[model samples]
Target: MITHIQGRLVEKNPTDVVIDCNGVGYLLNISLHTFSQIPDEESLKLFAYLIVREDSHTLYGFSSVAEREIFKLLISVNGIGASTARTMLSSITPQQVKEAIAHEDVALIQSIKGIGAKTAARVILDLKDKVLKVYDLDENEVSVNKNNTNKDEALSALEVLGFSKKQSERVLDKLLSEQPDANVETLIKDALKKL
Candidate 1:
């Protein structure tokens, strides 16, 4: 288990980086989020997780321990491999991943490029409690008002106004998450600007 690596950054790419630690240059797979956080010059440190299989040994690195923990949790779910976990992390920030699992927001999880509805639901079902516990988020933080119709109404209005359902839903979800008590009109207006 390579917990972390601290060394001079020899190479930097969107999906990977090479770090020169002592005399060895270690190549680490990284998500876009981590890639964005890494600087192009001098010394750097990344929290790392190594995966060993029958054929290959791979090392994935994250900009923060929190992201690494989320990656580990994501891969622990059945049917979610390291690559899928990386894709998930790459598709969204670690915090968003936590929020999706904690809130059981299947649609938000499914919106990721490779994840489907079933996988999204499975992720929520398998990890929601763990996410809550790991993040120290209580039920109150995870629970959304079941009677909240503002999001639904805003989505319907956006659809009627010719916005795509999926896009509208994503935008509306973001708006509602930012402003939980926003009215339909406010959501619609904010969503329109984002859409």
Candidate 2:
């Protein structure tokens, strides 16, 4: 298994980035959070998870070890896939997810695009205790109360699709900064480019 990749960030896309390691270029699908932290034309290092299927082999990258751990927990759910787990991280921070699970807030999880009430409940039931134990963070510390959900609702939508909040916010900010009234889908597309 490939534990991590370190090299020049030659290219970046919404769901992936290509890192040039010596003469070889490694393409890694990464979360929006990790995407935002990456700088163009610079050497980068990402903690990684290798997913092998009967038909394909893919590498998923994370900004931190903690985020990678969260991804593992998310994929362990019966119906969750890597894409869904990535979406969950894009919508909510690892800290927010940990807190939501600790408090068993199924509503928060359900709010994400592909997640339903039943799946949301399952996420809380199966991993709440485990996440709490792993992160050593209280529910209050990770609460979603501070976010401006009204302004962030569009971003919340993109995040569910696996674009990080930072990436979403930056793209949205720029779109609005110029047009000042771009619609949801336009903002999403614009933000996708930066991601």
**In order, what lDDT does every prediction score?**
0.86, 0.79
The clash numbers for all candidates, in the given order, read: 0, 1
Q: What range of 10 consecutive residues in model 1 has the weakest lDDT sum?
A: 144-153
Error of 1 at 143 (Å): 1.2
Candidate 2 TM-score versus the reference? 0.69
Regions of candidate 2 where Cα sits further than 4 Å from its true position: 137-195
lDDT of 2 by residue, 33-111 (tens): 7777676658899899999999999999998998999999999999999999999988888877877777666657877
Candidate with best TM-score: 1
Q: How many collisions between residues are there in candidate 1?
A: 0
Q: Report model 1's TM-score to 2 decimal places.
A: 0.79
Every model's Cα RMSD, please?
A: 5.2, 11.8
Model 2 residue 35 CA deviation (Å) reads 1.4
Query: Alpha-carbon error at 31 in model 1, in Å?
Result: 0.3
By lDDT, the best candidate is 1
Mind giving the per-residue lDDT tens digits that candidate 1 earns over 50-91?
A: 999999999999999999999999999999999899899999
Model 1 residue 179 CA deviation (Å) reads 14
